[model samples]
Target: MDRPHWSVPLALVWVSSFFLHFAWEMWQVVFYEGMATASHAAAIWICTKATFGDANIALAAYLAAALSVCSIDWVRTPTGTPLFFYLAAGLLITVLFEYLATEVLGRWEYNEQMPTLPLLGTGLLPLAQWIVVPLVSLYATRLMYFGFLPMREYAANKPA
Candidate 1:
């Protein structure tokens, strides 16, 4: 079946998100590089260390929350949400889910290298992923799947 044209706003959201994935990868590179510079071998260890224990658990919890929200298609407008607001909401949702799941789900626990006032204070890495990438990714995926936009159009129309 053929797909109809996407509303321009949805196209912008989709295109922006496509670029944002690259942006996140760049950030991750910076993070990993920073870790490496501290000491190459030690950086690898530290990076792995970052994912250790309950931190992994908390990270998983964050992904679940973000996935749940993303799955909803509840984003009200397919075009966009206020930029800062959407990101902030995504952050809140990720943090809340990680918090509640650790407190309630018991499916996992946080890998806190050192426990702090906040259960997994260092778990910010995972939370950031959920907020910045996955939420927009979800939006982009829906835009394509629902025929608000389609990959074939994208492929053909991509600038030469």
Candidate 2:
């Protein structure tokens, strides 16, 4: 069968981005210069801030990957589309969709968990999940979607 193709591979890729983001943040805390200079407690505080909460770098990475993968373009018409632009659009769509979904779940003004609902990333992360997610998605979409990604003639048809 068709390589058991479902959404598993793509989903895994997105999940991987989360751990990767977390690991990178951890590394920065341990190795980056002038990091947490005040004390060990200070260092932990910095690490915690970078890794969790609204602006949490780690969580932001996951969100970015999720938006990116979901955003990939599939041009229906014949007029070819730019991969980067398609990626951008996808990202933008993901962000907008997410914001709308969140709002529907619970209006921001009343949300204690997310105090600053109107200003995403001021309390969130990506100034525009609109732009950042898609830039990242460009790679993911190209990797996953055969439509946008060019086929290699060298790779023959799969075995029966």
Candidate 3:
């Protein structure tokens, strides 16, 4: 099979990551202090920005996976090592950033509802987000890339 252009997988990753992360963020907002009472517009804005960050992290993880296998097409048929690199990179990044943001920078804090890891105290939701979102995004990418999810036919010659 012919390799898809690099942009194809990248676009798929961004779209999938943004949508999944945005939904997760919205759902998990109540676990964060002050988020549940924020104005709708403010909540949307905050989630959108965070979604973009998540998308960027997904892109970076995708790149890391690609580099592990020495091909951007690894997403087409992901396997052991590349998949490992993808998940590990995303988890590592999320843990470090979550620590820095919550502890060092005081960027945000978890409410009592938010469960945390034992030692690092990283929120369980964010760690699960990294794992779940990337895996789903990669699965979505594979499905789309293989045409399992068909696009609408727009041929000019077909029945009008």
| Alpha-carbon RMSD, each predicted model | 10.7, 10.8, 6.9
- lDDT order, best first, reads 3, 1, 2
TM-score of each: 0.34, 0.30, 0.90
lDDT of each: 0.46, 0.39, 0.88
lDDT of 3 by residue, 100-127 (tens): 9999999889999999999998999999
Put down candidate 1 lDDT per residue, 9-83, tens digits, no spaces: 344344544455445533453333243245656544444433333233323333343354562233323323343
lDDT of 2 at 19: 44
Q: Return the top candidate by lDDT.
A: 3
Determine the C-alpha RMSD for candidate 2 after optimal superposition of all C-alphas. 10.8
Better of 2 and 3 by lDDT: 3
Candidate 2 residue 49 Cα shift, in angstroms, is 11
* Model 2 C-alpha lDDT per residue in residues 1-160, reported as the tens digit of each score: 1342445434543443344434444544433435535487776665555333322332233334444445322311112234344444444544554466445543222123322336542223333433444344434543554433243331343232
Give the lDDT of residue 9 in candidate 3.
Answer: 90
Model 3 bad stretches (over 4 Å): 149-160
Residue 18 alpha-carbon offset, candidate 3, angstroms: 0.7
- Per-candidate clash tally: 4, 3, 0
